[model samples]
Target: MRPRFVLPAAFSVAAILLLVSCNRGDLPGKKQLESEQVQASPVAPVASSKVVEELPGAAVSPLTVEQRLEDFDYMWKIIEENYPFLEVNKRLNGEDWLANKEEYRNKIAAVKTDDEFFRRMRFVLSRLNNGHTNFLSKEEYPWYLNTYVQAGFGYEPWINVFQQPNVLARYNQKPLAEQQSPNESNNDINSGEAGSQTGKTSGNVKKVIIEPDQIAYLGMRSFEGSLMEMDSSEIRDFLIEVKDYKTLILDIRGNGGGNSSYWRNNMVPLLINKPITYNTYSLYRGGEYAEAFMQARWLTGGLLPIANIKDEQMPNIPPEATTMFKDYNKNVDIVTPYQSVGFKGEIYLLVDSSVYSSAEGFAAFAKGTGFAMVVGGRTGGDGLGTDPLVAALPNSGYVFRFSLQMGLNSDGSCNEEVKTVPDVEVDPDTSKPLLDQPAIKKVLELAASQ
Candidate 1:
């Protein structure tokens, strides 16, 4: 059975006490938190550890190398036993699961410092191709960051306001408007050159066409890597140029989330006029009731501080660039509602099961504001809130992530267990053009009726 999401009895009481104190404005000072940290369980218990007797393949190594191999032999053992993914481990194998450790150990000595070990370890973990799995040491626990949490945006793009053209009443805004009426082209501003329209069935898009009359249709693939390091000018200019279209269709069908702040910054310009209240996230404990039941040791064991939340709001401390959290927070900039581009026209967003994490965040934000109409399959990931936590093992220093923060919708309801539902349900209709031109069709259909 799936591990039910619930905290123990004692933990509940402590959480309640802490929450009550905070609510009453009897905030616990740093000393109190420090004291709690000191008293908290440094280690959480898991199943018994199993030692692997032999390497998977007949690979011999030096004594130090062999010992390093053995150390990881134990490390993988502990993780498989304790990790939440029991079924996945069964398939990965009790022995071969240490493939990364062995591969790294075969290359470098295990006797190397923890820093060198983990640096190589992370590279190896990345090879696993599973975003959820990772390794971190307890010592490095304080500096770990699981979420692509952003602080805010550094630059805001400029937006232009233009009088929206009605094709039925104006006939000058339709596709081939230029070819149809030379008079309309004389005074009309050319926002951009009409590119050759490409039509096909790709991964998520059902059917879509690029043409002179259609607003620019954008498809964002994966959301990973560094945004601050990349140039945003091109992206900004692209969105600005597309603004001349009657309606923009943004498709995020298979977007497995990356850095939240990155999307926030990129999408801020598209969100016109006012800042809408985005969804809220909280830790996923069983709420007030579960808080009353959790034990002290379990409550603090492997527990981490979530970045920010509505209730357990993270306070701004002194900047520490050394920590990933601090660095990310400092680099992140939120797009204030009032500072957004107020696009006067309609916007359409499409999503599907592959849409997750930050993609869901983007969809959720767009959904909350009524700025865009979502049309496609429902999102696979939760729409409401997320408990963001990070932790490391004590002995091997293997880093890992857990759903620490639970998320809430704009209405403050729990959505962790429930994935985001679509406004308009759709399946990938491959017989048609890949990009679903439902938005364009809707507009065209409405225009034809008039």
Candidate 2:
């Protein structure tokens, strides 16, 4: 018998979104919601033994040639062992990664200063062309921390980017007469305005209101926080507060994704009415790592003793062995409504190039299921890979992260190769705020009609 696995609550939301396999937790029945609220697990802090220190005026120590080479080799080895999209990457970029590795390896030997070494390492990782695969040096990681504090992490940046004048101008340029065609029935008067009424929900959800229309807007800058951290009850209440509106505009523009479970357990359930099959299938690359993962489960009490090899289906290897194409198989997932009752209102989803990883997955799912009308630009196309495993260099303390599996679309398409196209395509003007854009007005008009 294949041992039944229960989804653990300890996993980070980021990990949960990146690794779909990890989200196979048992779903609570409808009655469960009436009985009590689902409690979220606390997120554990990542522990590192070697603390990176900062010196204001201390002498800068440059990495020696040997240390640089060692760090480069270690980073390269981690990717070689685990990166799941080597074949897809090659096909997309038309570059021989292995050959480039040798070329870059030679270049790394000549890099002198720590700055040069870090830059070179980043350049090498950029060859993968994968947003999830990256190198974060100890010196640079602090910038992220400082920036998050100053700009409110992901939220402020999204607001600043989408609210630019140039961005709003692009939307405003759409012919008002064209928008008011005979086929359109909504009594939407062109406001000719370019700003949104912004507020924060009790849950801290950034709410935007376009004037003259009751359309409710919510922006998901990232899926980073735990469901509890996000205040699920507040979110539910906010939805309830806006449930009477004609439409709900979900703006995920520039959302670089964090955790799928947050949306899955909290947002998704509230939006959906009936049980729907969102994820048709997921493909996993089977190899020594797969077997090792399975074995480790047994030793770690994650698998039952009765589990046998016959239950394990071998992966079908592709013809390109050098490209790391191993056996691939599919898995399915089904989503049901969270509460016995749900929001029956129309939903509009806003997407853009920065909408990546789990956000991309959510967009794909929402679009595939006809759950919402996706508007704006194509998604970032970074959701097709599995969760990344983080590794630190022995000498420089630079961290390398890479995916172990590749996720496929509902139709067995690679999301990394093909972006999720919107139902209504709108070219955003980067110079303006998203609220000021004409697309928001169009979406509002459509929502009013619905």
lDDT of each: 0.38, 0.53
RMSD of 1: 22.0
Quick one: best TM-score, which candidate? 2
Give the runs in model 2 whose Cα sits over 4 Å from its true position. Answer: 1-16, 19-67, 139-204, 209-214, 226-228, 280-323, 384-386, 394-397, 429-435
> Could you tell me every candidate's TM-score relative to the true structure?
0.45, 0.64
> What lDDT does candidate 1 reach at residue 425?
64
Summarize candidate 2's per-residue lDDT along 22-53 as a digit string, tens digits: 11112223355223232111111122435443
Give the lDDT of residue 161 in candidate 2.
25
Off by over 4 Å in 1: 1-214, 225-231, 284-342, 382-388, 429-432, 435-450
Please give, for residues 1-450, the per-residue lDDT of candidate 1 as tens digits: 111111232112111110000000112233553232211111111123452211111121223445445555554554433332232223332323444454555644634554444444444443322233444333222111111111112101000000112211111122332233322332111111111012211122222335555556666654332321231333454566665566667777666654444355455544566534433433333233223222321443433443343233333221221121210111111235322455565677877766666667667767766767777766644332222223333333244433323344545433333356666665623235553445345534433443
